[model samples]
Target: MIAKSPLRVLVAPNAFKGTFSAFEVASAMAAGVRRALPEAQITCLPLADGGDGFRATLVAAGGGRTSRHRASGPLLEPVWARVGWLPGRSGETAVIELASVAGLARIARPSPHTAATASTRGLGELIRAGLRGGPAEILVGIGGSASTDGGAGLARALGYRLLRADGCEIPEGGLGLRQLHRIESDRVDRRLAGVRVLAASDVTNRLLGRRGAAAVYGPQKGADRATVAGLEAGLHRLAEVAGRDLGTSGLEARPGAGAAGGTGFGLLAFCGARLFPGADLVANACGLDGALAQADLVLTGEGRFDRETVPKHCAIVSIAQRAAPNGPGSPGAL
Candidate 1:
């Protein structure tokens, strides 16, 4: 009889929301795998969907380092934010996750007033800091944001003057959008012109209308009906101005444009950034495909695994299915 080779196992998991992080989950799963297969070769790849844990996950996977900077929070308060750095052969890459600064989690309590006043200016500040490092690429994970200002605050942070009809700067947050009229990009940071900006998001909503950021996500952030309506109008005005001043028209209808309270739209319009699937971007950065190619068995999970877990859209499930013995590469079993 032929002897079988020891199993090569890969354990990759997403965070169990409201519980452990992806790194912690990966560690716990690795321990369980060790107990079950004492002699198996195990590999762990922690995963994220471009939200709260994105920076940590990528940094851990790439042996990158992190630096903290004081930035504005969702409520315009001072907060310490961390940016991940990954050195490459050519130049370094910076990973900036919006959750670190503008996430809803930063809010102690959700209220209509807080939702209306939340701003993504801090996220823009983080990006500006990252740019100072002279990175070749900036990977912005726009999820878990608390603002609906259409990236107006971000533009302001990067030196774009979002002025009112009277030529004065608007206030911060969604309410500020009401006064937004024109954008002056002449003062935008020159560094942005040389760096490639990529926005990671799974959202497909547009920047306006029913499926827009304010309409779909504002209520979740504590916005009332009236607040949502107001935010919607504000975002519409912002989009019109962005189109006219920045020549970035039709961005409001783009997929992922509504993510992070329309910060995605802001990034696209003002920074000339491109959008990508969060999972795919994270997976590639972690080299999951290479690991899958060598695995004989793969185990993947998240906090909740349900029928919504499909091979196409679900990150963990997709990784597992792709590593299956009958899957594309046909190398592993899951």
Candidate 2:
């Protein structure tokens, strides 16, 4: 019954969380497959859900290059972050992951104070650097963020001024939103006018309410009950100001608006970026369907694979189903 010559095997897996990158996981799986079937033809396609390892996964799959820059961190400290680039017919396409610069991983020990003061200014600086390359499209992965600033700090870094009632600039982070303010966007980077921006996220929480960023993710970030309540109030105030001053109404209720501590709302409001599911965006960019077409046997895994491993909206599960033996035109079709 063992009549097979060479099996076309596809190995795709998410990162092992804090232990290994997606690339490393794929490589390890590929190696194991090679050991079992020396003649098997294996294709490695690492995947991510837009939390971390997003940039590396995309770059590896797309054959892109990585560039590093020193930018502001969650605590306004300096950190070296990476941006991915892939050259195309139209121009270069840039991939930026918020976790690279503004993620909670940057904080050694997260506390209520750290959560209260974390900022997204570094993310804006990174975007500016990406724009300097004259990219046709910018793909931003907004997840694993430490701050809940409603993107005010990011907007300010990109030239939008957040002025208080007294005409003074507010401090950084969610705490600053307590001051009633107006937004000025005349100074926003002109390069972004023609560039297309796409934000990839995994969550679909709105900007305010029980499922909002502050309520859903605040405790994990070290925000106490009172702090979470303050953040919710601040975000509500920010929504009002942004709606009035910048005309970005209705974003507060938009899905994924609360992602990355409301950086999703900021991108939609300030940069006009459209949000998409991170797994789907990454799958399309990596040409997963095309790879599956040629796969005789498809393999997918993560550090922990459980009932919750593949959510209803996860593209990875869809890919696996499409490549199943019972699926149409699969290599194992009878």
Candidate 3:
């Protein structure tokens, strides 16, 4: 039976991968929902949980602006990465997504051995630049990275030194591990400590193992079978060094440890950041709960709804359902 009332509907959706942006998905869904309930008050909120489309999705959902920041790219080029700032009461917060700077998308075919050196150094520069303006908060989205250097490149850019046991500096990129040594973080930027760092990710793979970053994502980055094995071994050694130097263990199995290669572990270990679902952060920004409170119906969609799309991918369905009214004549769920 068709139910009629002065109903409120909320439409929030994530990206459908390479096809549509979250904003576009939400808009399309909202159109369909409005067609179903012509008189319903519909609120379209596009969301992202720190994946490839995080910045663009958030900028579209909220009144935000995108700016270009020069950063190190997957190939070590000085590339201009897209960063966004969402308007807030305590001034605007800069959304710096590592994917924008060091994402797998940026990696091209005919990749270079230097590609072996691809690092998150550019992401760190973008973060530092965002803070140069003294923004309220720095929200870092870590996902889709092309490098697997344990975020050593990022640490170096932030003023930490990756030194060999002989005190020589380590080169940038994952292959730099061939010159493995100790780590020196005494010179890391103190300003970073004063600001809040929030890491948004969905991966839970550790830093090293059969389930580690290299073994799982190496092929995606164009690593050959032998290269993968080498990277796996290197990561194990790196983790051991980290544990010995930092005096902490369990980084190898920490949820999101495999995010952006190994930057997830690096950020948690060094930056003192709290890791949360990319969807949760996006939900809070878009006020999904508040919209749901007023919503009688909900509609949503995503790029792919499959096994690989865990934690973050399910957010669309989950949030939409949670926001829908639970009554006999309440809105229909889709």
Candidate 4:
């Protein structure tokens, strides 16, 4: 009789929020697999979908270096954020995570007022700090943001002035967007000229209406019914003004515009950024597809399962679909 080959299992998982890191989750999964099948070969791949652990995962996969810089937090408070730098021929590729600077977790308390006042200034500051090194490209993992200010604060950090009708700078956060009059462009960051900014995210909503940023994400950020309405109006004003002045009119309608409380829209309007699926980006960077080809089974998961988690953009489902050869475009996984 011919001997059978041991089953090859690829164990991968995203971070479990407060419970455990992705690496820890993978380790636990690998241990369980070992107990179930002692002879099976297992490989652990910790995944990050542009959330809290994004920088670490990418750094390990790309063999990158890191630096720490003081930047504004989600509430505009100072925070020491880590920035990742990957090697390249002309210049280093800067990797930044929105969660590191403007994530909802940065906030200790959740309230309607704070939600309206959160800012993304830190993200833009990180980008500017990265440019100080003269990077070739910038990869921003934009999600888990606490701000709903339509990235006005991020624009502010990049040198654009969010002014009121009297030319005074507007306040911070989503509510402050209502007072936005015109955006001053002359002082906009000049370093953004040739840099390619890719906003890696999975959100598909636009910048306005029901599926837009405010309607979908405002509540999660602590907006009540009244606050949600206010945020919506503010975002509308911002979109119109940015369209007229920054020439980002139609980009607001594109998918992912609503991501991270309109941070995606802000990057698009101000930085000439392109949106990509975060999981796919990380998976490709780690060569998950190449490993998939050598595996007999792939096991993956995240912190929890929800309607959107399984059907839409959950990291586990993405890799599972990649492992399913019977499905179209299922040749690989991460």
Please write out the lDDT profile of model 1 over residues 235-280, one tens digit for every residue.
9889888889889989999988998899989999988999987888
Lowest-sum lDDT 10-residue window in model 3: 309-318
Deviation from native of the Cα of residue 198 in model 4, angstroms: 0.7
Reference-based lDDT, each prediction? 0.86, 0.85, 0.75, 0.86
Q: Residue 114 in candidate 4 has what lDDT?
A: 84
* Model 2 misplaced regions, further than 4 Å: 303-315, 321-334
Per-residue alpha-carbon lDDT of model 2 for 1-334, expressed as tens digits? 8886799998877777667878898899899999999999999888887878889888877889988999999999999999899878999889999988999888889888888888999999999999998999998989789999988778888899898998998889897798857888889999998899999987788999998989988887889998888888888999999999989899999999999899999999999999998888888878887888888877776565566445533545656655674456674411
Q: Pairing residues by index, what is the TM-score of model 3?
A: 0.85
Residue by residue across 68-172, what tens digits does model 4's lDDT show? 999999887889998999998888899999888889988888789988899999999999998887889999988788989888888999999999999899899
TM-score list, all predictions: 0.91, 0.91, 0.85, 0.94
Q: What is the lDDT of residue 236 in candidate 2?
A: 93
Q: Compose the digit string of candidate 3's lDDT tens values, residues 140-246.
A: 88877888887777777788787777898877777777677787778988888777777888576778778788888887787777777767766676677777887
Question: How big is the positional error of residue 313 in model 3, measured in Å on the Cα after superposition?
Answer: 6.4
Rate residue 142 of model 2 by lDDT.
90
Residue 267 CA displacement from its true place in model 1, Å: 0.7
Error of 1 at 331 (Å): 7.6
